[model samples]
Target: NAGVTQTPKFRVLKTGQSMTLLCAQDMNHEYMYWYRQDPGMGLRLIHYSVGEGTTAKGEVPDGYNVSRLKKQNFLLGLESAAPSQTSVYFCASSYSWPPGDREGTEAFFGQGTRLTVV
Candidate 1:
């Protein structure tokens, strides 16, 4: 399985520009998520899908959107970029997390998508 692969390992965007970062996994996992990491902050969830055709907003869903049309792919779209969005984006998946405990689940992460907004 490819696990997860994110396109455009690095990118630069001017203020107000837009971009879409692609994430694909071959594990056939049912859950997928998009998160952003900033200095001194832990990964903050932007959006997630429990399964294909289902999407949900997360803790930090503002300024971002997500789509899960295919079972193996999750796309994160930034319509208007801002300097505050200049952070490392990470896409993660899990085959199955340990039941009954959220912390017990191990999430597999992609290399990362770095976006710089001037």
Candidate 2:
């Protein structure tokens, strides 16, 4: 099974265009998150889903939207592409880590999708 898969490993969009990046995970993690990475900065959460049919905005949810239609799929959409929005996007899934287990707190992340808007 593909643990976590992201579609269109790379993409380039002209400013004002729109596109969706898909994230699929085989593991049934209770929570799923989308994040974007810029040079020198760490991953910043964009949106997240607690379960199928539920979605919420995150730290950087401003130019983007997300939907979790199924337990295994999370979709991130860019309504209108902008140069400021260009970054490496990542999808990650995680189970609730037990309070005392350090090793179990780590999350599983997809390879990432590199997006460029100009």
Candidate 3:
């Protein structure tokens, strides 16, 4: 089973261009998140959804939006790409928040989506 899958593993976008990254999981997780990884900065949360049809802003929400229309799918959209938006994006899903030693709390991540905005 594909734990988590991200579409378009790599992409190069010009300024003002728009694109959407898709994340899908088959683990039946209830929490999903979008994060970006830059050279110096570690993972920075972009957005997250606790369940289907629910989404919330994260650390860096500007220039990006996300939606969880289905229980197993999450989409991150860039309205207008920017240079600073260039980064490796990751999608993760977990069965619980504040992950602990509890079963199913461990997050499963997708390979990753490398995005470059020029």
Candidate 4:
């Protein structure tokens, strides 16, 4: 019954280091998303996937990439981590809603992964 889980609760990186954040869910959801939150700010979408083998960019996709090779897992990668990318990242998944009818849909969120770039 693990809703969602993110690996590496915390990490520190140099200005140009590279890393990947792993997210896994057992909910069998059709939609998955990656988001980042700065101190005292709301979450900002980084990338997302609609289903297995499908991915898309979200509000703040710069410096980040994501993959959904399997239906139950999503991975977010920082090719060259930057100081500005330092933040707490979150992973979420939701059941599919009908096209053009996304009302009242909710997602389950992971605890979070904190990353710092210096």
Using lDDT as the measure, the top candidate is 3
| Clash pairs (backbone) in predicted model 4 | none
What lDDT tens digits, residue by residue, belong to model 2 across residues 40-115? 9899999998889999989999999999989899999999999999899999987654322466545789999999
Rank by lDDT, highest first.
3, 4, 1, 2
3 or 4, which is superior by lDDT? 3
lDDT of 1 by residue, 75-99 (tens): 9999999999999999998766542
* Superior candidate under lDDT, 2 versus 3: 3
The collision pairs in model 2 are none
lDDT of 1: 0.90
| Candidate 3 deviant stretches above 4 angstroms | none
**lDDT of every model, 2 decimals:** 0.90, 0.89, 0.94, 0.91
lDDT of 4 by residue, 46-85 (tens): 9999999999999999999888989999999999989999
**Worst ten-residue run, lDDT, model 1?**
96-105
Clashing pairs in 3: none
Give the runs in model 4 whose Cα sits over 4 Å from its true position: 98-105
Candidate 2: lDDT over CA atoms?
0.89
Query: Which lDDT tens digits does candidate 3 get at residues 65-97?
Result: 999989999999999999999999999999888
